[model samples]
Structure formats: C-alpha cells, structure tokens
Target: MIEFLLTLAILAGINVLLACGFNLILGYGGLVSVAQPVFYAIGAYSSALLSMKLGLPVPLAMVLGALIAAIASFGLSLPSLRVSGDYLVIASMGFQLGIIHIINNVEFTGAASGLSGIVSAIESPWRSQIYAGTIIAICAVTILAIRWLVTGPYGRAITAMRNDEEVFASLGRDAVHIKVTLFAVGSGIAGLAGGLYAHYFLFLTPDQYGIFSSATLLTMVVVGGAATVRGPVLGAIFLTVLPEAIRFLNLPIAVMAPLQGVIFTGLVILFLFVKPEGLFGSKSGGGLDAWQSRAMSSSMRKGAK
Candidate 1:
C-alpha cells in the first residue's frame, strides 16, 4: 500500500513537471507549442545516454540535457516566415512525430525495444524523494515567477502581446523579444522536467513521447487553469494521482487501464463543462486549497456588494 501511494506521488510530481513546464508556453504565452513532448523526450533521452555512455551523474546529465533541449525549442519557435498559431502547432506536431520516428528506428536508444535500467535515473532510494521534492519546488517557484511577471512590466507585456501582437508592436514593446523569451523559458522547463523523468523512470522510448504526450501536457494546463500559477500543478497532481487510485481499486489488473481511461474521459468532460477556465487559473482567481479559495471568493463577492 505504501509502495502504491509512493508510486502515485512520484507520478504526480512527474506530471507536475510536464504540465507546468508546458504551461510556460501554452498557459502563459498563449502559444500553441505542440512539440513540447519532443523537448521532454529530448531531455530524457539526452540524460539517459549521457549517464549510460559517459558515466556522468544523473543530476549533471539532466541539466545539460535540459539546456540543450531549451536551445532546440528556441530555435524551433522563431517567428515563421509564414506560420503562426495553429499552423505552428501543426508544424510542431510534425516535428514531434518525426522525432519519435527517429527514436523508434535508432539503435542508440534501443530502437523499438526501448531503453532499460533507467533505475540509473534514480541513483538511490533517496534519489526519488529528492527528485520529487525538487520538481515540486520548481513548480512553486515557477508559479511565483509567473505571478511576478504577470503583475510586472514584462508579464503584462506578454499579455499585451497575447491580446494583440500588432498593437503591442505599435506600442513599442518589442513583441518579438517577448515571444522568443517565453518560448525559451517554457521549453526549458519542459526539458528540465524531462531530465528528472528520465532519471526517475530510468527508461524512455520513442513511443513514450509523441503527439499524445504533448496533448496530455496541454490538457494539464487547460484543466488545471491556464494563465495562473497554481492551475497546472493541481491538474498534474489530480490526473497523475487518479490513475493510481484506479489501479489500486481492487479491480482486475486487465480492466484497470480501461477504467482509468473512462475516468479521464469523464473528468475532462466535467471540467470542460463546469470550469473551463480551470480550478487554479488566473481567470478562475486562485490556486488549490479549497478553503482558501472559498474565503477569497467570499471576500471578493462581499467587496463587490
């Protein structure tokens, strides 16, 4: 039972990394970066290879892999000579698919067989605890940084760009710089998370990362609440932990996977209908801690009255 709960917490932490990392781009920047999974894969694969081949420490490998992946994302985000938004999304999706294809075929990554001995991703029993704590802390810091940015000159500039890039340019805010910076930061976070995932799970594969991975990351942002610090974290934690709960519900193992699917489908629908703005979204006005949010909401309502 403890093992099961431990597994759930680790899963939740990983999702937090994936979701919040992706949120930097889609949630805050309003950019449709469908290639986020690619960066995640890149981080995982890079760190894995480095640790296995070069005998590097997992921590160093993670940082290096993340930095490389971030640079790659920045390169990919260049204002297209012709593409934008959905078109960019399409392009990024293609890139993600292409990366998977390469990974699936490559011998270095164990090709179709997938990588193994990823326990190396977690150096020791304490490694998992430290990694999880570190990633969760990263989420909190990211939220604070995002909140500060949103409330400050730079963040408002991002919002201005989101609302009207042309108008932002007209106002002399250098919208291009904003876009580039956000893209880099967002992808960088994804890369960082990817590294941790690689180390924790110690196994990665081409199929493990694809359009579906990107979609999941996006879902975390939307379901958790975009444009807010706490939204993605809640989304990641809830979704990550729920699957584990289903697995442990004393059901047949064979049926558990599909049961999780049904639950996910239901939750997605419910969230969309009841709170599309997200549970912790800026638009929704807060983070988790239902009691605190309730208090804040009451105070605001009273203030309005």
Candidate 2:
C-alpha cells in the first residue's frame, strides 16, 4: 500500500510539472500547443540515451535534455509567428505526429521497442522515497520560479499580448518575442519533467509519449484552472489518484481502461461547461492580466492626481 501510494505521489509530481508548462502556454500565453508530448519525448529520450549509452551523469543529461527541448521550441515559435489559434494548433499537432514517427523509426531510440536499463540517480529500496522527495522539491522550486516570472515585467507584457496583441504592439512591445520566449520556457519545463519521468521509470517507450499524454497534461492545466499556480497542482493530484482509486473496483482490464477515460473526459467536459476558468482560476482573467490591470489602474490614478 505504501509503495502504491508512493508511485501515485511520484506520478502526481510529474504531472504537476507537465501541467505547469501547459498552464504557462495555454493559460498565460494564450497559445494552444499540441506538440508538448513531443518535447517530453525528446527530453526522456535524450536523458536516457545520454545516461545509458554515453555514460553521462543523470543530472547533467537531464539538463541537456531540457535544453534541447527549449531549442526545439524555437523552431515551433518561428512558425507560430506566422499563424495562430486553430492554425497554430494544427501545426503543433503536425509537429507531434512528426516527432512520434521519428522516434518510432530511429534506431538509437530503440525503434519503437523502447529503451530500458535507464539508471536512476537514486538507487534501490530508498529509490522511491528519495525520487518522490526530489520531484516534490523540484516542483516547489519550479512553482516559485514560475510565480516570479509571471509577476515580473515579462509577465505583464505577455498578459497584454494575450488580452490584445494589437494594443500591446501599439504600446511598442514586441508581442512576437514574448510569445516565442514563453513557448520556449514552457517546453523547457515539459522537458525537465520528461527527464525526471525517464529516470524514475528507468525505461523509455515511444508510445508512452503520444498525443494521449499531451491531452492528459492539457486536461490537467484546464481542469486545475489554467492561469493559477495551485490549479495545475491540484488537478494533477486529483487526476493521478482518481485512476488508482477506480482500480479498487476490481473491474476487468477492458472495462477499467475505458471507464477511466470516460470518467476523466466527462469531468473535463463538465468543467468546461460549468467553470471554464477552472477551480482556482478567476473568471475575469489570468494572474498576469490581474497584475497588468492593477498596474494600469495605479498609473491612471496617478495621472488623475
């Protein structure tokens, strides 16, 4: 029971990290990216191969994996500057499919059979607790770092761009740069989460990081209340544990698998209809928007004075 619970906790932590990245892009940047899983795959594969094949230390490999993802994000961003909304989503989906194909065909990636024997930084018996703790600590640091970023000048700029890119442009702000930067940062976060996931499981499979995983992460961000810090974390925990809780029903594998999907999809649809802003999110706007509004109001008051 303890082991099961520990596994749940670790998965929740990873999902939280994933959801946070989605939140930054979809929630704050107002960019809908369907290619997140591709970046995640890249991270996992890069980290695993580096550690397993190249003998690099786990931490260094993880960092490099994240960096590679961030760099890849720039490629997506260039195209994004040309289109947005549904078109951007389609482009992202294309990228996702393309990457999956590459992973499946690439020999070094184990050609769809998946890669195994990934060495965990934390060794056995104590591995579970230590890994869970490390992930939690990483999540905490990420949350704080993201909070700081979203409250600063860049956050305000991105908020302006999200609300009205034309207005932001009229104010002489470079909306393109902000969007690209946020997208890269979000991808980097996803990559970091992927690295952790690879090491935790000590295995890699192309199928594991497919469109379904992207949908799940996106669902986490949406259900948790996209722009808020606590929303994704809460959503990740709920979704991660909810599936395990359902298993206690002892339903057949066929029945159980579809049932979990049905439950999760129903909840997401319900949330979309009932509270689109999410549990912790504001109906008015995201955290960035709130800060921007306050700043503008204060300036206006001073001008009046």
Candidate 3:
C-alpha cells in the first residue's frame, strides 16, 4: 500500500514539473504549444539510452538528456516565431506528431515495441521513497525557480511581449531572444521531468508521450489558471489524483480508460466555458486570452493582408 502511494506521489511530481515548465510558455508567454511532450520524450529516451547503452551514471545521463531536449526546442521555437493563434497551434501539432512518428520509426528508440530495463538512480530497498522524495524536492525547487522567474524582469518582459510584441520590440527588448529563451527553458524543464519519469519507471513507450499526454499537460495549466504561480501546481496535483481516485469506482477496465479521457476533455471544455480563469487565475487579462491571445490573432491576420 505504501509503495502504491509512493508511485502516485512520484507521478504527481512529474506532472507538476511538466505542467509548470509548460506554463512558462503557455500561461505567461502566451504561446500554445502541443509539442511539449516531444521534449519529454526526447529527455526520456535520451536519458535512458545514455544510461543503458553508454553506461553513464543515471543522474548525469538524465541531466544531459534534458539539455538535449532544450537544444531541440529551437526547432519549434524558430519556426513558431512567425506564426500565432491557430497557425501556431497547427505548427506545434505538426511538430508534435512528426516527432512521435520519427521516434516510432527510429531504431535506437526501440521503435514501437518500447524500451525497458532502464537503470534507476536509487538502488536501495527504499527506492520508491527515495525517488518520491527526490521528485518532490525537484518539484518544489522548480516551483520556486519558476515563481522567481515569472515575478522578476523576465516575467515582466514576457508580459510586455505578450501584450504587444511590436511595442516590445520597438523598445529594444529583443522579442526573438525572449521567445527562444522561454522555449528553451520551458522545454529543458520538461526534459528534466522526462528524465525523472524514465529513471523512476525504468521503461519508455512511445505511446505514453503522444498527443493525449500533451493535451493533459495543457489542461492542467488551463484548469489551474494560466499566468498564475499556484494554478499549475494545484491543477497538476488535482488532475493527477482525480484519475487515481476514479479507480475507486466499481467500473470495469475498458470503461475506466475511456472515462478518464472523457473526464479530462470535459474539464477543459467546462473550464473554458464556465470559468476560463481557472481556480487560481485572475478573472480578467490572464485567462483564456492568454492561451491564444486575440490580439496576436488580429496582428497575424493584419500582417497577412
């Protein structure tokens, strides 16, 4: 029973990391990216291969894997700089699906069959406890780091850019730099979460990091309240536990899986319609508008005309 609880805790920690990293771009930077899971996959596979194949220390390999994912963030970031709103979403979706397809076909990634026997960083009998504690610590640090980031100059700059990219650039703030940097940092954090997940579970499956996973992360950010520090943390923990809580129901196996998906979709729709600001978000200026800024859409359309 303790082990099961620890497993839930570890998964929650990972989701917190993923959701918080994503919040930097989605909540604050006002960018809608469905490609976040790709970075997570990259970090997981890269860390796993490094530890399994190269025989590096699991911790070191995890860090390196995260760095690799951060570097790959440029692929989406650069192209995305020219697009906004629906175009941005389409581009991110394309990137997300394309990368997963590549992972599916790639030889070293174990292709469709998946990879296992990943080395764990903690080998003690109390492995679950240690991993759970470590992940929780990492999540705490991540939250604090992100809080500091979004509350300081970087945070203000992101807000300015989100509100008016043209004016921000005119003020010599280097909008490109901010956007790329934000992507890199956010992707890197997701990568780290991926590493933690890989080492803890000691397995990697391509299907686990697909579109639904990305949507789940996005839902956490939105439901918790975008552009707010406590929103992602609260949303991550709540959503993580909600699915587990569903297991208490007297439902069958097949029904449970689809039911969870439906619940997630319903939550997003409900929040968007009923309380777009989320539980911890402000009622104005930073809710759904932050997800896909109407201003950005208008500007993009104007530029195209």
Candidate 4:
C-alpha cells in the first residue's frame, strides 16, 4: 500500500510541473498556445537520445534537452504571435501534427519504434522513500518559485497583458515581447516536465505526446482557473490521482479508458458550469475578499469593443 501511494504522489508532482509550466502561457500571459506538448516531446526525445545513444549523464542531458525545446518554442513564437484566438489554435494544431509526423518518421528518434530503457532520478529499490522525498521537494521548491514569480514585477506585466494586451502596449510595455517570453517560458516549463517524465518512465515515445495530451494540459490550465497560482497545481493533482483512484475500481483495462473519458468530460462540464474561473482560482474561491469578480466582469463588458 505504501508503495502504491508513493507512486501516486510522484505522478501528482509531475502533473503539477506540467500544468503550472503551461499555466504561465494560458493563465498569466493569455497566449493560448496549444503547442505545449511539442516542446514536451522535444524535451523527452532530446533527453532520451542523449542518455541512451550518446551515453551522457541524465541531469546534463535533460537540461540540454530543455534548452533545445526552448529554441524550438522561440521558433514557433515568431509565426504564431500574429495569430490569436481560434485561428492561433488552428495553426498550433497544424504545427503539432507536423511535428508528430516528423517524430514518428525520423530514424534519429527511433522512428515509430520509440525510445526505451532511459534512466530515472530514483536510484534504488531500498531507496524508494528517498526518491519520493526528492520529487516532493522539487515540487515544493517549484511552488515557491512560482509564487515569487507571480507576485513580482513580472506578474504585474502578465496580469496587465492578460487583461488588456493592446492597452498594455499603449502604456509602453512591449506586449509582443511579453507574450513571446510567456510562451517560451511556458514551453521551458513543459520541457522540464518532459525531461522528468522521460526519466520517470525510462522511455520516450511520440504517441505518448500528441494533440490530446496537449489538450489535457490546456484543460488543466483553463478549468483550473488561469490568473491564479493554486489552480493549476490543484487541478493537476486532482487529475493525476483521479485516474489512479479509478484504477482501483476493478474494471478491465480496456473498460477503464472509456470510464476515464466519461469522468473527465463530466468534470469539465461541471467545472465550467459552477466555477468557470476554476475551483481554486480567484480570491473568491478561497483567498482574499473583494469585488474582483465584479471588476473582471465589468472590464470584459467594456473591453469587448
């Protein structure tokens, strides 16, 4: 039982890393970039190829992989910024499909066979506790780091851009730079998650990351409530463990997938109906007490023009 619980905890932390990283783009910067999984795949493949093929140390390879993903994100940003809303989503979907095709067809990435036998951060069977502790520590550190980031000057700029990009630009703040930076940083976070996931699973595969996975991450950010620090983490943990809990239902593995689909769809619909802002987002959810919701609503009504 302890062993099983530990596995759940580790997966939960990973989901937080993935969700929060993408939150920087969707929630804070309002960039709505749907290609997060592309960077994630890039990170995983880079790490896997380096570790398995080139025989590099795990940590170094992961960092390098993340950097490569960042560069790729920067490339994606240039053509993407001019497009926004649903149009931007369509372009991002195209990019994702194109990238997945390249990944599956390319020899360097093991083509459709996928990459396997990668290393993990955990070192020993007896040291499972230590491994779990290390992962939890990383998650805690990330939480603090995000808190610091969201409360600082950078946070102000992001919130401003989220509320009003053109107005922010008119105020002499470069909205384009902020938007692009948010997208890149978000991708970097996704890359980091990818690296961790690759090491955790000891394998890499193109199908593991696709449009649906990207949508999952995006759903966490959106339904978790963008513009709030706690939402993504809360949502991540819930979604990560939700399936694990469902696993104990004693259904066949094939039946399990459909059950999960139904569960996720229901959760999404319920979240949208009750607290469209997210379960833990906004001070109204459980934080400060103010008329912020009214203010947000008023701003939206006026900004529609």
Error (Å) of candidate 4 at residue 225 is 1.9
Q: Which runs in model 1 stand beyond 4 Å of their true positions? A: 79-81, 119-122, 125-127, 282-305
Global lDDT of model 2: 0.83
Instruction: Select the stronger candidate by lDDT from 3 and 4.
Output: 3
Error of 4 at 292 (Å): 13
| CA-RMSD of model 1 | 6.9
Per-residue CA lDDT of model 4 for 1-305, tens digit only, reads: 88888778877787787788887776776665788888889888887778788888888888888888888887778898788767878888888889988999998887888877787765788455775676678778877887888789988887777666667788999888877787777777777778877887776778877888887887676666666788888888887777667877889989999898888878777776776667676745321111244356547878986
User: Which tens-of-lDDT digit does each residue in 181-289 have in candidate 3?
Assistant: 8899999999999999999898888998888888888888888988888898888988898877787786998999899878868777887789877878876655566
Taken over the whole model, the C-alpha lDDT of each candidate is 0.73, 0.83, 0.87, 0.76
lDDT-sorted candidate list, best first:
3, 2, 4, 1
User: Residue 19's C-alpha lDDT in candidate 3?
Assistant: 91
Query: Residue-pair clashes per candidate, as listed?
Result: 2, 0, 0, 0
**Predicted candidate 1 versus true structure: per-residue lDDT over 1-305, tens digit per residue:** 65556656777877777777677677666676788888888878888888889888878998888887888776577844247757888888887888779988989988888988763654566765665677667767766776687779887777667655655788777867777777777777777777777777767778778776776777777788776677788898887776666665689877887888788768877887887677766544432222234445546767978
What is the lDDT for 173 in model 2? Answer: 90
Candidate 4 minimal-lDDT segment of 10 residues: 285-294
Better of 1 and 2 by TM-score: 2
For model 2, how does the per-residue alpha-carbon lDDT over 1-305 read when each residue is reduced to its tens digit? 78888888998998898888878887788787778888888888888889989999999999999999889898788888888767988999888888888899989888789888887877778888999999999999999998998889888777778766766898999988888888888899889988999998888888877788878887787777777878888888888888678888889999999999898888877877887766677766643343355456657767978
| Candidate 2 local lDDT, residue 148 | 91
Alpha-carbon runs more than 4 Å astray in model 3: 291-305
Which parts of model 2 are misplaced by more than 4 Å?
A: 286-305
Name the Cα RMSD for model 3.
Answer: 2.6
Better by lDDT, candidate 3 or 2: 3
lDDT of 1 at 106: 84
Candidate 1 has a TM-score of 0.86
